[model samples]
Target: MMNEAIARNPQIQSMRYSLSSRFQAVLLGAALGEILGTQCQVMQSQQPQVKQPSQWTSLSRWGFSDSTLANRIAIAPAWGRVAVQLIKGLIRGGGGETSWINEVLDVLEIPFEQSNREPNSERNSSEQDEGSPLPDFPQIDAGLAIAALPIALFFHADPHQLEQELQQADKVWRHRPELSDGVLAISYALSLALREQLDPTQLIAEIVEELELNRDRPTTTDPSAPSNSANFVEQLRFTQSLNQTSLDRATAQIRDQLSKSQTGLDALTIAIAFHCFLNTPEDFCLSVIRAAQLHRNPQTTCLTAALSGAYNGISSIPLSWRSALSRGSSEHSPLNHLWGVATEAELQQLSDQLLAAWSGAYDLVHLLNYPGQTFAIAAPKVIRPH
Candidate 1:
């Protein structure tokens, strides 16, 4: 059986190889989108015309935690930047414009090249986080979800299209012959779901239909095989036909678990589009859910529970990060110089806001998929320290 074979394959044994490569793709895409998203809308300006922090600090308006944003950008902006780059690459590859990513890059004064993709030949390359709790590789579902960047934000979208992307990603993973199917698919789910708002019930129905379809098929359906794509397309059509309330009921059950499992936004990132990037706060929760549903690992479930307990009163932006630029020197500051210098207190606040954004993103995802469901839950629970 392909499932059994895949599980035993030596290449799939380590998650490191797969996760790092995904970083290159997702970060590139996100960077491009962010640069374009920030163009006309008022968040913060690249440069100030006045002495007012209000004019210079557009991120303040969007509730950004400047200290945390700086730390994240410094620590692993490669993830976000790579995502932006990928979108630009995709655009250019398709013969579209590249100006969007370029604008953000120009303003931020960041690199035009992809940051994290270490050349395979270079022995120094690795997936390990620089002193963060998140794993270096896609060892867990939550971890994989985090590694997949913006896609995780889109999980609550229409499953038909998402599934296609997942399949394509899987195709690449399978060719590598070393990645976990459950791990990769979960990551694939998260990547597709990012930055897109959808109806929850619609998303749930589509997923349910997809599960049934996958359950009924051969593991290695050949692309060259007749009607393979056709059958997949039919599944999407079928899920869309479901009644609204039914879809909502199913989605509610899963969402409850997700809400319960959220611990913090330590893992979330600040996106140019607030909806696009979710840093890895307690990704292990979602990862565990994937492991359980897919029968992979039990910690995925435990992590989810742990995260839920930790996620009581989170704020998206840490106060210290928020204040770095909130009160600052009059000099024209280098982005890196201004981004640094955060107190522990500031980091905590930024963390809370990041969690809130993820929660908001999750809601939007469900809404986009299940256009018919009235699946409105209260806002994300925030956790603040004494």
Candidate 2:
């Protein structure tokens, strides 16, 4: 059972409505960013050559990638089951070696065979021949951070409890230490922003400092390994330094200085940089639009949008963007095709359920209306372009 005292904590109780709105913003912003980022990439790649000026055709299809899907799983009613499994495993003296990862995979209905496959195995022979060692397990995809967002919000009132939950969840992809750190940073930032109402500059500074402190802690998978937060901290600091500049210049500077790789520290850096560069969480549309134009990694944009949205809340997002997203074409509607439901309406419901779950008010009624099974059935195994 959830800690009743914490559920009724004064801070959380007072801010319930605000937190609910932020949760909705995080999920909705992630989906919208994915859509816009995908469209931007498609547009750039398909630009036609012509002697005379002509209007470039835009891709009509728009959908979110794996990041938003993982977020859906994170906030699904089924996640309560995983929480129970974690407690049981801990009680059985399993420590951090619990089967929480398998539970999440099962709840998401992702086949073990598929999840275990090496993400880089499909790379061309030339790339493989470069002598880069294959990861012991599949590298932690950046999308996994999306799964940690709700967990962060759930434990926002208690930083210690939040860290414990994050540590347990980090075990799911222990091989990628940097990725885990990145996820933790994003979650921690969101929690503080919601609780403290910190501005972007203060939020980024606080997050970097927290991560720096975490650098000395031993990892769950490897007690001897040093914390991997250094690179992320450095990147975040750089991102903060760019706050005074225009979004375009900051983005271009980030693109030039960072590796645009959609994995490990680079991807995390990109997302954080975008969030810091915007510094104006209220302008969700401009933030996501800038992110989409930053690079080809839609996941980065999605993550940035999620973070920004968490700070700004759902009402801060532009109505135009929300309306446009909800009206996505039949084949490309992420909510309908990828999530197996109407987008805006369902997100609102999920956001409420997540708040209810954290508040210890989750009941059978909410579960029946939005069953855990819907998450597994609706989410696609893979949505990112190769």
Candidate 3:
């Protein structure tokens, strides 16, 4: 019955009505995007070395085979797993701290010993192509963006806390200081979405400005290693300047320019993700489909979907995708055992609880003895929906 209610209205009316919807959208959207993107990546990897050019059309209608869907269920991406951990940590009152992030990583089975052996091992890996070969090390990758989702949503109302918390949480995975810029850029985008202030036309410029402002601050990246922030900012600006009407054409033009430059994969992933979202900011499915088919990097798709999801809310996502995810949950599913979520309903509950925590109403549900309660507390003097 409660699940049915959520299905009817996932955005439980609270002091901040749509805010609850955005919370669920960010988590579930990122997770669903991760799944779809991974499936596409797997399919792409299996393709023959030589590929043929395809028509300029959206592959949003691409069908996933049963085997592919089953495979996706078996192996959730590390970023998605970490994202779940981040959500859980926030609900538990954990905040921006290396110790707190490390504890979360430890629970997720990250091998700390490997990090010790490969402090400077910077190679493209599975979870993210942006940074080190070690899974534990921070790199300018999509995983960091996804992992920062919780902090971004939890502290969406406070820019200072948002930046500070993201910076601290990112410390657990050491990498080039540019990683901070990437994480902050993603978080800032989401924060804007949650605040209902995201302007797609001005997002790139705003992020570039934000990145430039933080450059003077001390960084965790090696000072000897030249900062990639400027280059990324330039790429983003170039991407934003394209006035093409067709996504395929724009993607081609942007990809051509990026190929001629020295932009790192981390930067490339973020740039493309932004491009896809900015192109179809109003259409979550279209934006995510383009990311999945074009970028082919799970992180790119994940980030794009997350941004779109936060902006559009859960209701904006395709009902088919939402239903499929809800049905995928099973008692023995790896998603349950590993991510601690057995169904879409559980994920929604987690989002509600996080909102409740953020609203200073952590005890509301318990106080009301409503284990299945979904509404989050809203502060006084805030607008409420009729």
Best by TM-score: 3
| Candidate number achieving the greatest lDDT relative to the actual structure | 3
Lowest summed lDDT across 10 adjacent residues in model 1 is found at 268-277
TM-score per model over all chains: 0.28, 0.67, 0.77
**Residue 215 alpha-carbon offset, candidate 3, angstroms:** 1.3
Off by over 4 Å in 2: 1-17, 48-100, 103-135, 170-173, 224-226, 259-278, 328-332, 337-340, 365-367, 370-386
Q: Which wins on TM-score, candidate 1 or candidate 2?
A: 2
Please list the C-alpha lDDT of all candidates, in the order they appear: 0.29, 0.55, 0.67
Candidate 1 lDDT by residue in tens digits, 1-386? 65565466533333222222222223322222222122211122432442223232342233232223332222223223333333333322321223333333343354443423466733333432232132122221222322333333223234444444344433223322222233333433333333222223344344345555764655443343232223222322322332233323423433453344343111111110111111122232222222222211212322222222122112222233223343443232112232231232232222222222334544433333443443323223322123
Which should have the higher TM-score, number 1 or number 3?
3
lDDT: worst 10-residue window of model 2 = 50-59
What's the CA error at residue 92 for candidate 1, in Å? 1.4
Candidate 2 overall lDDT versus native: 0.55
Ranking by lDDT: 3, 2, 1
lDDT of 3 by residue, 292-383 (tens): 75666778888888999888998888887766554543664434533457787778887887787777774644723554765646633454
TM-score of 2: 0.67
Which of candidates 2 and 3 is the stronger one according to TM-score? Answer: 3
Q: How far is candidate 3 from the true structure (C-alpha RMSD, Å)?
A: 8.5
lDDT, candidate 3, residue 281? Answer: 95
